[model samples]
Target: MKKKAMASFLIGYTLLFTGSVYWHGQQFSQPIASDAGQLLPTAVKSIEQAEGEKQLQEMVRRANRTGDKLSIAGMQHSQGGHTYYPGGTIIDMKKYNKILQFDPKRQTITVQAGATWDDIQRRINPYGLSVKVMQSQNIFTIGGALSVNVHGRDIHYGSLIDTVESFRLLTAAGEIINVSREENKELFPLVIGGYGLFGIILDVTFSLAKDELYETHTRVIDYSQYSSYFQNAVNSSQVKMHLARISVAPDTFLREMYVTDWTNAKDEHKLTAYNQLKEDRIIAAPKLLLGLSRYSDWGKDKFWELQRTYMKKGNGKLETRNNVMRSETAFMEYESSSRTEVLQEYFVPVSEFADYIDDLRNVLENEKDFNLLNITVRYVGKDEQAVLSYAKVDMFALVLLINQGRSSKDMKQTEEVIRKMIDITLQHNGSYYLPYYSYPTKDQFDTAYPHSKEFFRMKRKYDPDERFMNFFYREYGQ
Candidate 1:
């Protein structure tokens, strides 16, 4: 019996891993483009590689000459059509990546826009330095993160905009200009979260932080108690990084929650003991488990139970900051022609968290085909540095991952639920993230982002010809 069970497990693992490899490794045919969401496949004029600044400038000039709109693409992780436009040229920046400068004394690094956080981590990990603010996954490019002005688990920082020192931009007219807080200050805020409508970000200089060791802590509590718990225990303590997961399992379903906090290690000497950067490992098993959670309620309950057990076992583990930033994403890879996983984030003022969660619970419970998979919560300090900033106040961001079919009916159902969620967000004085599909009405967007008119106006002022464009601009700018 034991041998048969072991054989069955091995066979399942092999099939799952093989499927993942095949899906992730497939290549697309020419003139076809899509973002990571795989929801909107577009036919484009051409896709071009960006080799250097001069080459990029020439490409932009040629696009303007030919009346072809240009869109910038990095790792293309955005669920929205932010990276491509129909009949437009895509400037692929992945190969233009290179570290331009690093100042060890000041703890600053400048790199080409195409450089991924992973590239920067490998270079600076040896010097005991790390990125101050970035997304949870390292596969995303710096340009893409800056365009979105992303945030992560760090409690000490505000958002990615706070750490950016300077960057060079290639405007629509093929002019390269240096932009920073001190010089070209007006354009500074407009471009960070401008969603590639401004221009192509060439290279960026960012402030860095010293690498430190952290001791992990985890606790399970009622969903209502989370806001108060974070305020009193996590924020007022030595916790440097924190995030929480509200249960999506059928049994718990927004009632049970677990918080993970990383505080300074009790032993400073342990920093060196675990300072080496860690890479993702043993992903196939987790991928299999996530697949189970995506399809069945029983699988979700078991997955939740296993997740709690995993977090419990990880309590008090010591890890370096770089290793923590290198969060595993391989296990979440999903590829299906008929179905896909989509992410939508909502941010509510800290005071409105419980109320917002209550409404969210009601909505999810009533919608049977919603296929809500996971919800991870992170805190963002009040930051208005970016013109399109999402965190107007000290807010709790709920990142929701849902599985949906590809049919028109499925999309309509998904959009309806999303609009309902957005309406709830507005009622709670909150905002939804713009990196996803354009499900919210124009009125909802204007209400959430009052300064969006100014942002779009500036986009036209900077590029009157509309040489730089994407589906995001088409959805909101016009």
Candidate 2:
């Protein structure tokens, strides 16, 4: 009898322990931080999923009743403090992700706000379809992409807003509104790039394009000749995608550039399935190169040389649209806890591309201890819809990817470089992206985004208590 009782007690204890462990694991998961690992903040509460419209409404209503500020987060890739509010409620949208509808004939997809581009690609690729516009990587959520109004290498498409057919937004008052170019026109621009200040994105419907085969081509040209080269070669060609990479080595510096152009190819049979390429190796190579490049200038030169050589193929090699569009872990390589990599983008008028590059090179050369890893140039046409549009005019966006130590001193130096870059951008009648670090002063912010005051007024009208707030709005919305 004693032995039987002991055995039963042990079994009960083991079961209880196992159940508790599982429960705690699910309940006490740590709060998420931005990709840069810089903007981690503790929230008073977090809701992982809305489950449905009624649940989302209840969550928002509860937050409003308790006078709690609510912050919306998707993949949390934005470097700035956009994902979390201090001691506030964070609504994690990842679990809410779902493909709500797909119209194969119209080539359109309507998805829950939390669905990442990767999710969309997986679903659409089987049909030989691809997203019309997205950032280079596929990890970002559609809602996050819309909030930032991301642009890609598609020079013709301009920005994500250009492809968006419509989206449903849940206001602070728990009312869901459908906004598009034709309907609810007043809220269209504001909500697209509003950075989740006005409302919570519920679902997004966007147009898609048929994936096609492309032939890869490249040309190494002087930085000064890029503008003319693009106008003559790229603009006239049937190129579907294009971007130019400028060397960051001290020797070659910004003087040399490699243009990678993908033009439509006749050989459709060469198109490969989206999942075939071993992205781990493809992604790991760059991270390894970047790590080595941080040590010496030789490493930097060799890395750039390798990139040009490896990426370029002699004229007839076929590349699929999805292959070019898919990038898995290339941007997710910051392994150092003491240092981080950040991105800054500036859009300059097409005419000012050369001058802006020159000034940028000068500023970078003058700055000490600056790790200018890469500079990618992308062409963007005018996007007049977004109230705080980055590409107000047809422009060439210069994207700078740099590394900085986490120390305060390194951050200060980084800020100095950023300020000088911003000043140069302003001098050239350009605007800088606001999604990264909050280095720009209020004056710079106002000058870059003059229509922000109106955007803030709309926020006030929509969210009377300023319920939806983040670092970007806190710093610049006023």
Candidate 3:
């Protein structure tokens, strides 16, 4: 039981994780300080007991009466980085995990908030069903995924919220309320990506595609042809399941086109899945050398080898989707950037895609010391399920894996690059995805999520005592 309890640390590291990680009755070790993919801090970790309605209600009353912060729980993968702790109590929901029910006829399942994608995967693998959308990684909890309304390689699968049929929210008033598409449709729209601000999501019901799904196809294109190539791929009739474009163009070649395709879930492209599942292997090279590829045309074969060797360690012809998302062995082993303090995941409306791309390229070229890696452009459809939802349109999400680990001057340059990215996205009437690491000015957030007022209103109606604010709340929350 003690060893089982230590799994809660997967949430990543923070400078001051609260002192609460004991389960069934054993504490976890203090996490080593490094920038590598982090583990949950030893502090504030606790086992997730099955607190009945009465117990939950009593806890709420005590919190409300004393104005003590409630322990907020869910998957803690905020790209905004280390923004949720210290004074804000944590509710580690790892053990609250359970597969409540599966409606095979409806392709939907109701599960506890703490269930990870992996947990869901193991259960559904035999039945051949899977969530419609998942992040680049699958280690996050279901509640966290729904709260953020995550998206992925598929343009048509919709964000995670689109698949949610219902969610049971435990209000700050200790009221256990059941909400769904048919009931409390009002709350459904707001709470999906509303973050845990509305209530503690006890369980969620969402649609899943049967394993009979298939994704077949792959095309590597240049960015110069992005306008023509991307729209064509999205509009393609040949591809069925997955459709995305990755830039394999020369780093100096701004015109990297999409490397994308379609696959079937049930059919299991064993060939394709095999490679994706393989773990990444990196040969730790100096950080500076890594930056040179973006500015110069390191030969495609050379860069490809460099990436494959450094990331995959060797050949990975026999990998799986789960492997692709789970393994972080590709990241540098050296201490993660001390300066790695900010992240910005923004979404622009479909109509603004072209302008946004042009603007992004201009910023990268013109901004001094502006280092950007892993620029991922994904598409998302409308989700009425979440008012603060960033997927209001077919979103062309330009994920900026920017490098900010440098001196103050370099950091300032990084900020300007982010500022440019945000300003342009906002000007185009786009919204910001709040889950990732970011340091957007309050004004930017306000403009990006003006409907945040509705989220605030929902929180007041339910979590009035302000028990669940995260690092994000430090500046803009109650």
lDDT of each: 0.87, 0.79, 0.58
Put the candidates in TM-score order, highest first.
1, 2, 3
TM-score of 2: 0.90
> Against the hidden reference, what TM-scores do the models get?
0.94, 0.90, 0.76
Q: Clashes in candidate 1: how many? A: 0
Winner by TM-score between candidate 2 and candidate 1: 1
lDDT string for model 2 (1-478, tens) is 2565335323432321110000112454644334343623343445345577778878888878998888888877777877666656677787779999998899999999989888888888877788889998777888889999999988779889999999998898878888988888889999988899988999999999988888888888899998888888887779889988989987789999999888988767656642343253335566556556755577688888877776665556676777677745542354444566778998899888888889888878877589888888989988877998998888889888887777888888888889998999999999999888788999999999999999999989989988887888888886
Native-to-model Cα distance after best TM-score fit, residue 133 in candidate 1, in Å: 0.6
lDDT of 1 by residue, 1-478 (tens): 2565345434543442211010222364447877767778887778888998899999988888899999999988777889889888898898889999999899999999999999999999888898999999898889999999999999879989999999999999999999999988998999998888889999999999999999999989998898899899988999999989989999999999989999999897778779888887656556776777766787788888877878878999998999888888767766654677789999999988888889988997999989998899999999998999899999999999998887889999999999999999999999989988887889999999999999999999999999988988998888
Ranking of models by lDDT: 1, 2, 3
lDDT of 1: 0.87
Shift of residue 53 alpha carbon in model 1, Å:
1.0
Best by lDDT: 1
- What TM-score would candidate 1 get against the native? 0.94
